[model samples]
Target chain A: MKFKQYLPASSSDGKAMVSLKDGGTLGDLLDTLGIPPDVPKLVIINGISRGVSNTVNAETLTDGDVVAIFPPSGGG
Target chain B: MEAWMGKILRVNLSYGDYHIEEIDPDYLRPYLGGRGLGSKILYDEVDPQVDPFSPENKLIFMTGPLTGTGAPCSSRYMVITKSPLSGTIACSNSGGFFGPELKFAGYDGIIFEGVADEPVYLWINDDEVEIRSAAEFWGKTTHETEDFIRAKIENKYLAKEIRVASIGPAGEKLSRIACVINDKNRAAGRSGVGAVMGSKKLKAIAVRGTGKIMLPDKEAFHKAVLHARDVIRAGPVTGEALPAYGTAVLVNIINEAKILPTNNWQVTYFETANKIAGETIAETILKRPKGCFACPIACGRLTEISDPQNTGMGSPKYFKGEGPEYETVELMGASCGIDNLAAITKANYLCNEMGMDTISAAATVATAMELYEKGYLPEKDLGLKANFGNADALIILTEKMGKREGIGDIMAEGGYRLAEQYGHPELFMGVKKLEAPAYDPRGVQSMGLQYATSNRGACHVRGYAIANEILGVHVKTDPLITEGKAEMVKTFQDITAVIDSSGLCLFVALATNFLYEEIQSLINAASGAGYTVDELVSIGERISNLERLFNLKAGLTKADDTLPKRLLEEPGGPKGDVCRLNEMLPEYYQLRGWDENGVPTTDKLSGLGLQ
Candidate 1:
């Protein structure tokens, strides 16, 4: 049911990845991955900022989806 | 008075009165300055029961003895006060020409007390200081407010460069994470101190001073400085990695190490981290190396992004500014699920210009995005569909939050409060109510403990375990194991307090001579004080205890020092990695010689010269 997977920037070309389950929002994917209800994850998709529960358009997964992700954060 | 301006200025907004008080040598010698001095003042002067945002809560902007001395990174200073976000002692340090300028202006610190009945700006010209009405400058952005103040002063020559620390509409509107930005974009951008300043009706503070500074031993000082300069230039991390790419380079490094937390910390890897990496950011937007006063490292980046969509007065790259450093990239880009170079750069610029803490604001928006995706908040409530990965919404929310308007209003409450308000308390990924920085706890185990006990909430700069976990600066360690991290964390915490209070940038931690023979050489040559490596290291320990004292006085208990539930419970990131905070906390307390509850015993405090 997972839609599209995103590889890590440091990955050798393409390896490590993250994906949202099909027809699932980001939060639901979190449940599937066992991410805590209160744990915060910063989600960046297509240069736009959103979080878990961000709906996954499965059809658009392999299209022009240039996404990034980071943990809850602060500037070092 | 030979080495110090020897006076602290106290401005009482509640009474519309101001006074100059002499700084005692007793306080100076014991606490040193910067965060150390600021901590002592807060511990002694502030009442624990007082509300952080109330006029009674004092915001102290303090510089150190070495500040303005042309010492490496001497341009640093810190703003210490009760933080609106964390409800603990918050000390957010910044670097630029401002700290030095404040020192030159014949003062050790500015102690802001009480709340102003109306908007105003503080004007300090050498010894002549005044509180001027700033109603005209109210709601203006930081750059504009500073520019307008100098215009009003009519000092002509000094007006153009009169260093100003100003708050924007975010502060004026009382955004909990609003920042006080100075020297264009060098910001003390954490913990909502700007909102506290704004609560005092203070728009900006303009300073121009020409007083010459006298060091304890000028000859020795120069020699030490020269030695440190060599250490910096020859050092691998400082000489090349930073000078070339800045902190943004960490994106690739950490991501490669598999500790780069992405998607609000739900994951430990960001596939597109390299897209907005330091090297790429430099190639695309970095114009030149920018520097703070006396800092040769010039780790700061001055950039110009040419994206037509992001071009305008609000964008930093529209003209130029300090940065979209690593943390900003993580917070504004990776944290929010945004992978666009121009978009994150634009948000970084806007945050700086509008006087906002990029970390908290990004985390807030990211939290809102998470919440919005969870159905806890509706698009109708936010006036827009703020689902995760909405780059435009992230940017717009950044702007709104900076102004404390629209959706920005809710986002600006910071991640913890915002999530709590939405009846989804567990979604807040913070320690001490301060939002966590990048680097998932699971992937980098020690980082979890580091964030848990950071003096200013969930900050990584306080004791970045990444040096060991990812970069292997000290030694390589399993990022997933909590085994011996307690001792390492305590050692770093102690040494960091020393370095931070000494007015040195943490990049020194990356210096090849991290053992500090070079710094030892510098200290001996300049101050004429023959200090061994052991003695020098002790300074860090001393400073750490002092900061702990301040936090203790502010009512932080061992219980208050903890990681968020997600890190502890969620097993999503790297293999079987959960925040081993509890595993390390007790050991950390033991290593710190504190009680089981993380409280510093009277004996331990006195042992460190708190006596």
Candidate 2:
């Protein structure tokens, strides 16, 4: 899993890969990592937004699933 | 014209007559310049009830005291008018060589009043202002118009260095989303400012000068400039990230927050954000980084798409141009659900050429796509399918919007009118007829209030609360809560008003380490207008109040200061799913010292020296 620049600095470093169980939901991983679930953030699994097959936080993560998290930022 | 060129050029195109007049120093002291001065002029000279396109309407292009003073990012000018789209006081700021050139040409600003009897373009060559017939250059694109006028000047000495501000076919056709573009890409890109120029049959403003600005305190100004540069260079965003990725650096960041506004605001996240993100552009398409005048933080992206299939121009194997910045990427890419960066880039190029506002243009198309998907709009009427994720459709629609051809005629009116025409006005993701730029208000809750109350209508720069709520640029606040947002929004809006009026890019204040004190010092040193931080803040407040007064007098009531129905009702992202606009607006009005109707009280006006 990779945390993008927008993630809270205290939560996780973008440089390291974290290990997780097979079939673990994104919410489960976030809970285990002590990441806040109620905040506005995007969950991408294996290069796709997590909502394609299931709710963003409930999407099942399998072996080798690449996950990344980011926060909101936009202006012209 | 001395110190700061205390002169303004008044051109009455109706009679092809113009005169240079001195601006009162008394007025200059209170209003400063740029947005503040422009707003004061508009409020005083033009009647609030007049039709925006009427001869009674006037367009003012004003620069600030710091402009042409070699201050960082000081190449800024403002175009102020009543918007044909929003029916509000509109002031659009642009950064390029034009503002500085105009300053060097011995004037602080130019005011265009009354419609022209024929097409004309203004030529300002160091005090010799001429309203030249523009019949030959009337139909040219902004780039071509600039080239044409620059080449037509009789003065051989300064012809090569002339700078131009122009409108293209979109503006010529009176498209409400049309913008005034300068220096190839930079634009006064909101509120139909270009259409105002077109209404007067003004093709462009060409300027050339050899005059030098005499700073009030040369040594102090230079020292402040250097300090400002150092401050920006030390900030993470201004020093590194922005230079590396341009404004698109926010693509993934915004998407990660699930506030990227995809599929016409129906979806909050886009799956292909990375493909059209800043990092991707830098790694693949970017040719080089560019910057505005005297700017050390070069965040402008210069790009080229090499694939022939991607360049909408059939035979062209490559296309090079200036941006599809974050707002363009989101509005033209994510909001339209077209993830193809090449198509978005092409659309961006077309917008620049057409002198159109990309945000409103894309928002117009996005609204149509929703109507099309819901079967409210038929293909027979559209001339093409506009399904979400259709990159080709995005390009086609953009070209159509620019030319105002076929169905483009209606779309050119902007999102509000387009949606209202289709009997689904609720589908229009906008406030006061102006489409909100990239950010989803449901994710960044404060932006909801900011957009609703923005004097120019749904603009981000008016009060970019996103910096605090999301990026933590100034102070980190809980994005999901409405608590303290009203006060935060008021502060940001006031400070931003100061920056906008000061002839400096707002990005420096938001993305760089240079804040209020540094900006105050720079303005003081350059213009010799010694002002405390509190006084600067008061000027910003006064400007905001004046704009509000105009809007109110023009008939916008408290009821008009609200977010779109969809954003207020629909669920969005994982956080507090809907925008808390109601909870914030009241608090915002209170903090602004306005009544429950969002009207500034006489006492408050008196306090700000407005009474």
Candidate 3:
């Protein structure tokens, strides 16, 4: 998986390359990266928002998916 | 009379006289204040086709009822006038201490009509008001003008309390992109409002007040305010990201999304965007985060540029100021393909000091660079290498634009005129003649519709679809799809109108819990208007239609409500998509109760009480 992390508190640097087990969910990736569960984040997989909700963890991740995680941020 | 000061000061600069008028309570219920009330007044008084710089074009400075009421982020003020750049009704909003001060001075707004025979500044100390000759302050920069005015106030304590909103050399030179700078750095920073101020020969308005705004129900208002503040503090975007990184934090996120417009919309991503991102600013130049009055977010950046090599001729070697905000960094840095943070910050300081809108100034420079590269513009015209990524050229051209010197005279007219002069008006990436902000609309579908239909021209803040499309503020939508975008854009535009009218910073919307209900509660508690959420939203719709009527009367046609040719045809996104504006426009018009040609229907107007 190709991971892009915008949260400074994340264990991984800005961009990271990680190999996830088959049938791994987004929560697994978060766990591998040491991202805390309580932290608010907006996750996007292939430009679609996997919103920061309880159901987000159950959303299965696929191989080669571009997972971009950002802490709550906005601009005009 | 509870929240509103219930009085407006009208100054006839031509006659050097002023009058105070009472604001009807009925009007307050419908129009609210700030942009809504100000736009209603401008539409009623000024001829739609009046020359923006003519004496007939009145300039209004307005504040909302929530302003100075100890409400969160209640520092906003609106500058309403005819736009010299777009020939449309311009309502530029700004935040700082100025608006609250005006409210405390016993007026909801100030309207300046006609041209002054000589340069002058308005000095308001509580109820006392004067139009004093500003001949000595005519040539001063905004910062210097504020300092000079304060020094002349006599009472040091009173002077310290003074808040000044003034234009600099750019406005004095009638630069169409000139903006009014307040509190040293914050600006009413679009649509040439400052040019209108300069046209009237008005130098500045320095105000100091030792009064308080009366809230009808202090207990209820305090409760509502506490809840609102709690919502803001609880949201990660408003409470953490913004306060920690400032608005420029969007740099990396936008760049990562491949939607950050680069090289003046020729591309959608900047490779070196991280170098100028908020993190970099925090690590390098950021002194601290600043906040407007009663603001909990505090997204404003207090920065310093210490590099002597970054300074241009006639500029200080070391300087401190606010911003290089997201728009500034994007337009001046990435849009020009220049990654030098110090150089970008220096240019930002110059734009602020000289009182120019950074978006238009940099976008115009970028257009000039494109024209120069294409051989459409001659090198002899600029007398410098106007190439992409040339930091020195950016700095020099920005200074010249502010001063209206050399080719910057043409540039001061803005990007559209600059490109048209060079035989390629298609190259100007803007809508309604105003340069587009940082986002490449192709990447975010609803933003395309927002830009095309924005009453004030190409403004992102009118309806920031990115919040939904990218940040998932309200609802996350697929950025590349056009489905349901019309409704989304319309909804955002209406809510934003209400927010702008309420004297509250729009950043409050970033908070997950701060929605229509929160806004309604605040308004009801403070103003005693007792408007339901639906009523408040209808007020926004009314404001929108009224501004649209003004624009339509000002000679804007359906043709003017469009993105530039580049955005319409060019594939500038990660997925090589263009803005499918056609799919959304018809739906948007339908949603807005407008006819096929984007004009509001008689029934709609009547329903909104505009008829």
The model with the greatest TM-score is 3
lDDT, candidate 1, residue B382?
86
Better of 1 and 3 by TM-score: 3
lDDT by residue for model 1 over B92-167, one digit each (tens)? 8888888888889888789988888889888898888888889898989998897788777555898776899999
Candidate 3: residue B511 Cα off by (Å) = 1.1
lDDT of 3: 0.89
Each model's lDDT comes to 0.75, 0.84, 0.89
Ranking by TM-score: 3, 2, 1
Shift of residue B293 alpha carbon in model 1, Å? 0.9
User: lDDT at B538 for candidate 3?
Assistant: 94
Interface RMSD of 2: 7.7
Error of 2 at B490 (Å): 0.4
Model 3 root-mean-square deviation: 2.4
- Cα lDDT tens digits for candidate 2, B1-611: 23468889999999899998999998877788999999999999998888988889999999988787788888889999999999999999999889999999989899999999999999888978889999997888888888788777676667788888999999999999999999989999999999999999998998887898877768888999998888877765677667777889788777877788899999888878888888778878899999888887778889888777666342388778899788998899889988899889999988998899988999999999999999998999899888999988888888898888888999999999999998999999888999889988887788988998899888898988777676666666667788888888888898888898889988887554567898899988887778898889889899999999999999999988988888999898546489989999988898889999999998999998878
Between prediction 1 and prediction 2, which has the larger lDDT?
2
Worst 10 residues of 3 chain A by lDDT: A1-10
Ranked candidates, highest DockQ first: 3, 2, 1
Candidate 3's C-alpha runs over 4 A off are A1-13, A22-25, A37-40, A46-50, A53-65, B311-315
| iRMSD (Å), candidate 1 | 12.1
The candidate, 1 or 2, that scores higher on TM-score is: 2
Per-prediction DockQ, in order?
0.04, 0.13, 0.41
lDDT for B562 (candidate 1): 84
